[model samples]
Target: MANVNEPTTNYVILTPEGVLHGFSQVEPSEQQLALQAMLAPEQTMTAHEWVERYSEIWLDMFIEEGWVEVVDKAIIAPHVQLDDFLRYVSASLSGSRRVAIGSDEGFCLAKMGFTQQEADTLCVAAADFFDFLKRQQQRGWAVHGHAISFFSTIDMLMPNTSFIFLWINNQGYWIIIEDEPLLNNRAFVELVWGIKATGERFNLLAEQVLDKKAQLESDQQAQAEEQKK
Candidate 1:
């Protein structure tokens, strides 16, 4: 049996052949097992089964360690910013035709080997398609209710390019490549979680600023009233 008090070593590697390998000194817990099952190509457990087996405490630890993020009562996978996340994605999808990051508001944050105008156009198309998907769900056409991640091979906007779309918080990311997709890749999953965590941090900072401004305005109003009295 492994010593409970002794430190354990865990490592993950992405081989040049694109195979992912992971190892741990200690046996995985039920939660870890459940997560692994969910990550499998032929997922072993349903969402409900996975939820039942998953541990909230484990999730809390991931959040505390900045591996996961919570935003507006929803969880965004991996905690990372736009720039760093893009870098990781770019490296993972090396030699891709184009890789772009954008928001639902038709704003392109960054792109590789593409003009700003082209990026913007792609973002708009993604946003429109996302909206259309939601509308279809509302119309009962989508029996699965909603999807957190999806892809499109038909490039209606950009010719000769296929793209994958991932939604992180209120933002969207696009990876345009010929035949490779990052939807199930470890790097892509990390990008999603990291971006969500970044968004949460920004929201908290904005809230603090707004609260401080409100307090200052109240203090000034009190001082003026006292002087008038």
Candidate 2:
């Protein structure tokens, strides 16, 4: 991987989008810079391979006590690792209705409506005990609601380490302590969404799916009315 301070030897051609010209090229941001440094060369990985490798690293970092299954189909951009994940959390999802937390050692993204103290408390809890997380995971408790976002530790230079993400949503709170967070966001959102959008991954397809479902329901209703006629 290239040093963060070193410029490329040549102006390797890139698209108008200004994405990097190297393997696993993403947007040219600090997160991408860090990611390019930390990750295995993209030439050596397929998309699926990236996901699997990320999950493995995450498990090693966070699975102190319980079993964790990375929901691959549920994530948007699964290629993202730790640094990219934190950039998303700190810059993107910080103030949104949902909360997200990310670090190089481990990353956590959660939706939130909790007070700052509550949020801080959750962070403390995650930082303090590995067994507590395990019990909650085994009980199948929801971590996404109104609880809090938590990040136990932050270590920039470490590899294959651990972190925690607490995501709060309308439904509940969710805690993900993995080696990395699946940091996904929209191009427009990353540039314009501001601080609150930082930590969690976003899915453009989720919105599309919701629209499609609504259209299907409308079509069904129309068909039913025609049958009555």
Q: lDDT of each model, Cα atoms only?
A: 0.49, 0.33
Candidate 2 per-residue lDDT over residues 1-229, each given as its tens digit: 7688984331111111222111121123433332232222221133345335444453333223222222213222324443354344543333332333322123233323445455455445544444455467569974322222334447443222223322111111223222332233332122211211222234445777899999999999999999999
lDDT of 1 by residue, 89-208 (tens): 765653453567666556777676567788778777767766776687678884231223333545443234455454443345544443243444556555444544566667888999
Residue 99, model 1: Cα distance from true site in angstroms: 1.0
TM-score of each: 0.53, 0.23
The most accurate candidate by lDDT is 1
